[model samples]
Target: MSKSSIYLPAGFRFAGVTCGIKASGKPDVSLIVSDRPLVAAGVYTTNQIVAAPVVLCRSRTPSSTVRAVVTNSGNANACTGSQGDADAKAMCAHVASLVGCDETDVLVMSTGVIGKLLPMEKVKSGIEHAVAELADREEAFFAAAEAIRTTDKDRKTESRELELGGESIRIAAMAKGAGMIAPNMATMLSVICTDASIEPKEANAMLRRVARVSYNRVSVDGHTSTNDTLLLLASGTGTPLQGDSLCLFEQELTELAIQLAKQLVEDGEGATHVMQIRVTGATNDASAETIAKTVAASPLVKTAITGGDPNWGRMVSAAGYAGEPIEPAKVSLRVCEELIYENGTPLKFDAASLSATMKEHPQVNLDLCVGGGNGEAVYWSSDLTTDYVRFNSEYTT
Candidate 1:
């Protein structure tokens, strides 16, 4: 989508600027500020070893009076002990002072290189410059999106508008991620802002519900990161939504989040194909998700996708070992809509044609049916390529 067409929600200003934090001299600091206090909610990394910003932000979220977010890239500020914690708080303190709000009213997020200390001098300067340049324009939002990226080849963003109570409500979101993805979410960081009026409780509930099905359903290399965070802020500039309107807002929010998540997967480091896996007929949703995740995380399955090979056995074997109860006689598998196996037996089909089809499509769909049960799940993953391995091998060098 063109940057000019991107929508900017009411009551928010954004800025992204370079601060000499990245070796490449790219924009490394990003700020999101609201003209008025707004309700805020967050979902953080499930990884026990979280970054300092994650810890600081997690404690103060689901709040009704948050005012801004301060972020920096190229320094994750993780595994740096108490000093990292102090730096995170200091970032909030500085932004709070500039934004004219209490320190706790600001949130913080950081990504890139773990176990490195932030260059405080550069960070403080960056935050000050970012705040000074903040603006509520599409260009500002685009800059913020670009600044937060690390390994991402392209910025991920989406916006949606809906009418609620005869007033327009806008939702805009930006995300950054290209690797370290898993079911519990990964190194990804996302900020979603809406002009609709919402209570803190509802905002928190909706963020978690949407995240479970969106950010938490994608995997790149099955390695969760220490700085995954998804924050939602409601400026309440639009009329309060109720009943059907509220449901519609949540639906739109979910769709927007899913779009950003898929963008992250599509931009995975040197990725060529996105694997869209669907697992049905499991004992429960949890079981279905486990099976799907197992297949997504399997190197053998991913490699087959990278090579455009219709290796149905690799997928079937991965599912069987997923620790879920499944009867082989009741299981069926399909790749790119072509049935390859059914009811415990391999089906006779044109392997060459199916392989060609897989190579021709950017999204390879894998459908697995274990039994005629009600449980089902969908997951997204990127095929593992030689380029992915090469890029990550020299990531820090």
Candidate 2:
């Protein structure tokens, strides 16, 4: 997206700068700031080995006082012991001082290499430069999005506008993720900004509910990151959405988040096709999601998608092994809208036609029914390609 096409939310400013943190000399540090006090909520990775930045930000959010987020790429600050913890806090402290806010009012996030110490001097300098350059412009917002990227092929941004309580509200978000993704929380580092008024408690609840159906439903490579986090800040410059208005705001938030999540899947490392796996007729939503994730995470299924092979056996067996209650005799499967399997019997369909359809489109949809029930779920996944393996094998070299 270009600067002219983007939306800059009211009361928010963004900045991104380079400070030698990345060997490629790209913009590696970014800041998202608000000119006024705002309600904030966050969702983070569920990995047991959490990153220092995630720990610090998790304790400071779901508040009404947060003002800024300082982030850096090229160093994840994960598994680096106590020094890593100290570095994370220092980053926040520096941003707080620069922005004239309390230490707790500044949140921090880091991505890139894991198990490495952050170059604090460079990070501190970058923070100073970013704070000084902060601007309320679409170019600045785009820069902030670019600065958080690691293996992503493109920067991701989305915006939504809604009319609530006779007031116009806007929600804009940016995210960075291309690998090490799973449905364990936010799945990546994302910053969401809005001008709608909301309470801290309500914002927290809404974030979780929105994340459940959006971020949590996306899986890329099935590996969860240590620094995955999604932070939402509401500037409350518009009318406070309540009653039906609050519900509408949440719906828009969900739609915006899903757009971002799909972008991440599309940008998955070396990805060629994105699979929209839908599971229906399960016992419950949770069970449906389990089956969907299993099918999406299957290496056999992903590779089949990469080769445009209409292989229904891999998908059926994946759902059967999801540990959920599944009756093979009652299962149905479709690949690229072609019913290839039904009720434990394989159908003789035009496999060449189905394969050609998969090859012609970047999005491949698979529908699976595990049993006769009402539960349903959808998951976004990327096809496993040789390029994906090659890129990951040389990621640290």
Candidate No. with top lDDT: 1
Quote each prediction's TM-score.
0.98, 0.98
Q: What overall lDDT, based on C-alpha atoms, would model 1 receive against the true structure?
A: 0.92
Task: Output the lDDT of residue 305, model 1.
Answer: 97
lDDT of 1 by residue, 1-397 (tens): 5645676789999999999999999999999999898999999999989999999988998998999998899999999999999999999999988889999999999999999999999999999999999999998998998899898898889999887778888899999999898868655999999888998888898899999989999999988999999999999855457789889999999999998899989998989999999999999998999999999999999999998999989999999999999878989999999989998899999988999999999999999998877789999999999999999999988
- For every candidate, C-alpha RMSD to the true structure in Å: 1.1, 1.3
What TM value does model 2 have?
0.98
lDDT of each: 0.92, 0.91
Query: How well is each residue in 224-273 modelled by candidate 2, as lDDT tens digits?
Result: 98999999999985556789989988999999999899999999999999
- The whole-model C-alpha lDDT of candidate 2 against the native structure comes to 0.91
What TM-score would you give candidate 1 relative to the actual structure?
0.98
Model 2 residue 64 distance off true place after TM-score fit, in angstroms = 0.3
